[model samples]
Target chain A: MQSENLISPGFADPVFQSQAAFRALLTALSEPGLIQQVAPGFAAPEGLEPATAIALLTLADYETPIWLPAALRDGPAGAWLRFHCGAALVEEPAQASFAVIDGAAEAPLLADFNPGTDQFPDRSTTVLVQCAGLAGGDIVTLSGPGIAGSRDIAPIGLRPGFWAEFSANAELYPLGVDLILSQGEAVLGLPRSTQIVEVR
Target chain B: MTIHQSIPGEDTKPAYNYAYLDEQTKRMIRRALLKAVAVPGYQVPFGSREMPLARGWGTGGIQITAAIIGPDDKLKVIDQGADDTTNAVSIRRFFERTADATTTEMTEDATIIQTRHRIPEAPLTSGQIMVYQVPQPEPLRKLEPRELETRKMHAWAEYGLMQVKLYENIARFGEVTTTYDYPVSVNGRYVMAPSPIPKFDNPKMHMSPSLQLFGAGREKRIYAVPPHTSVRSLDFEDHPFRIQSWAEPCGLCGAKDSYLDEVVTDDQGGRMFVCSDSHYCETRREQGHRGTMLADASASGLVEAKS
Candidate 1:
């Protein structure tokens, strides 16, 4: 693909678009398992979903190094991220502040990415996974800070044993990586405080 | 910093950036806020920037408000629950001049309320965010005085020092003497300092429907208590946590449930009690709630209460 084609139009209005996107992200994160629409509102590369593209646009800067899967690394999404967000794409997941991956195709061990040290868990990498859809999969009940009693979510196309791994991840509270699952234009936040229970 | 265009629909760059903070700085704060929300009570450190005002004031609250604020937001700034205070007025005007956001004195009308030392008397509803100006974000800072030790304590959920302090207060004063800046256990894990709000206001933090965000700019730390989260003030089984009670209702508005402030009326130490929350008191008075001190309207020449 030509370099120009990879560099598609980003946010039309950077300030307002980013603020809107950030609010969406904030609501999703604060209320785990709650779905919020995050629209880039512009043309992006083929590989990047609107939710993922807008998240990266609103958050990732030159300072926040990004880790992408091998296919996306050399593809249009990588170039687009670099061009629009000025993100430094890292080869290793541990080196990145953000790791963008397609969970349907690749399911790397969650531990493979940085969970950060016990002292500073906020330093952990925030994993943004592109899922198949916000719904239509195995249902899991979520309980924790944001939730009142409990909330159920069923994000499709997660790898096998993802809930078991997520259960273990919550046990490492204030240390595990936070997940922002995106599908097309909708996003769901599953932070470290979230407990995924009874996945069937 | 490079000069970047900020205004919407206009190519001509303004004198200041949007909300008076650069995009990069706002992004940094935004990222930190997400982590803070995720952790619930764990203090997430961020790259604190120098504001137009100094750090000791409401800079932390201002920074959080700026990062989250947009043109459409209705902001309400409060200093010790009064909207007309100097700190509140200056910060309100700052947002108006920079972000071009509409400012309101009424708590119910605000989408985002930035406060120092008190939560509003009115109950916070969902879809509203309460940003607190925390002078000291770390609850254990006073006891431990070392960041490294405190971090380890939070990591291990070791809050014995906090308990010991409360125990010490009980031994000394027959109860938990620490009133304002009360320590609370968040989510049964990290112990958090709920700013310098009166002990009377601490109960309001529990299961608040509105999202609560706390920022300490001088300390470069941010923490949160998401809606419906449990925030229990530390206390023993026998000697439970209690809020302050007032014998007399508000002298101006006759509000019995709200936090009260004592005002000296004369040189001979004559005193009267009034609601600390100016807006709340005004709203109550407008509803025709009269106190013992309030002059009777329609029958008296003075509609306003005399000092």
Candidate 2:
């Protein structure tokens, strides 16, 4: 890890900033497909987006194992994460409590990560993926506990079969990866319990 | 990002960290909270911290409020549906001093409500969050004393023992005798204890717009039911789950729908039922919904003035 990469400060007032960011994260997860803005002024390395960086800083700690994809692993993003959050960096995706996917196109299958067990389903992974935009891609309809009736989202940059993979992930019920899709300052959550269907 | 050295009125009590719990502890709990929301009804273990209050005195709910609340949130605390009770008032004041957040007794005015043993009669909206103080997070604790075995049972979705216990209740009494702390299935997946709220309030948890979070301090567990989640109280098909009802309306508020607490006025078995939610009762009274007790008091006062 390079020393210059660690120059970026964490939260200036760690207590308040992290608290606000965490609350935003909680609201995003609780209301699936709801896009939220977090830590507006916090800057990250070249590869990492602001929403992704804020999510990591708010949720990850020493107990959490963060897995970085090849691009982030070799870049300044890894060092910035290590310097700010102090979370363990895992080489394998299956062992990660949190995983960062730089781009939605390069994202791995949902099954590649831990789905946790029936009793301890919360042991699964939470993946943060950078997307091109929160809106203007293939329209996805989400219906689940968080949604009152149904919600329509158009997330860009995902590959062709992303919804199929996500549907398969949803079939796991209580055990599956929770996703946070980020683009610049905006982020949207897609918990495993949500049923996603791509509109024709 | 300027940090304050001391807030005004710091001399009243010992200086505490923002929201009482430190940043590291808050982060740990926040991670667990996300997982808890992801897997609705599943208990996620975390490092439960010691608070100024004792374990059974709502330490779990306090830690949760401290973790999620900021300076902008308006908080409400309730004990047995009353905001003026000692436990509720103390917890409300604690947050006011530590988090520097606004406090309210009105249900509709609050963004976050930390409750012990009851949900408010008023319906919760989409943006509100409810934190429940749970003495025991596990619904299967009475059936299985060992934590390891209970965890395995939850993992396997083996709720046969719980069903059997309910069956035994049916055998002893004609219907399910258990009233408070009724067990419910969240999203049809995991069996959860809806805190200690009366079964009358159990249905309110079903498909609620507001997010619901449960915390058990001694048990070191946190669980959640996100907005619009399904929560069904466990019961048989033949005998459906039912809420408690009183033959008489509230003596102070004239409300027939609210949960009532019977108050003894005289030793000769004379008693009056009043609304347990003091705020609700007061609001109704202000709206000119007078109960029998209020009517009687006014009548007596009029006679005294005439005399």
DockQ scores of all models, one per candidate? 0.63, 0.72
Candidate 1 chain B minimal-lDDT segment of 10 residues: B1-10
The digit string of per-residue lDDT tens for model 1 on A1-200 reads: 76666468888777878888898888888889999987535565778788888899999999999998988889889988999889999998888899887877645667778888888888888999888988989888998888888999988988877777778888888788899999888999999899876786
lDDT of each: 0.88, 0.88
TM-score attained by model 2 = 0.95
lDDT of 1 by residue, B86-118 (tens): 999999988887888899998999999999999
Instruction: Provide the lDDT at A200 for model 1.
Output: 64
Give me the runs in candidate 1 sitting further than 4 Å from their true place: A1-6, B1-14, B296-307
- Candidate 2 ranges beyond 4 A from true positions: A1-6, B1-14, B295-307
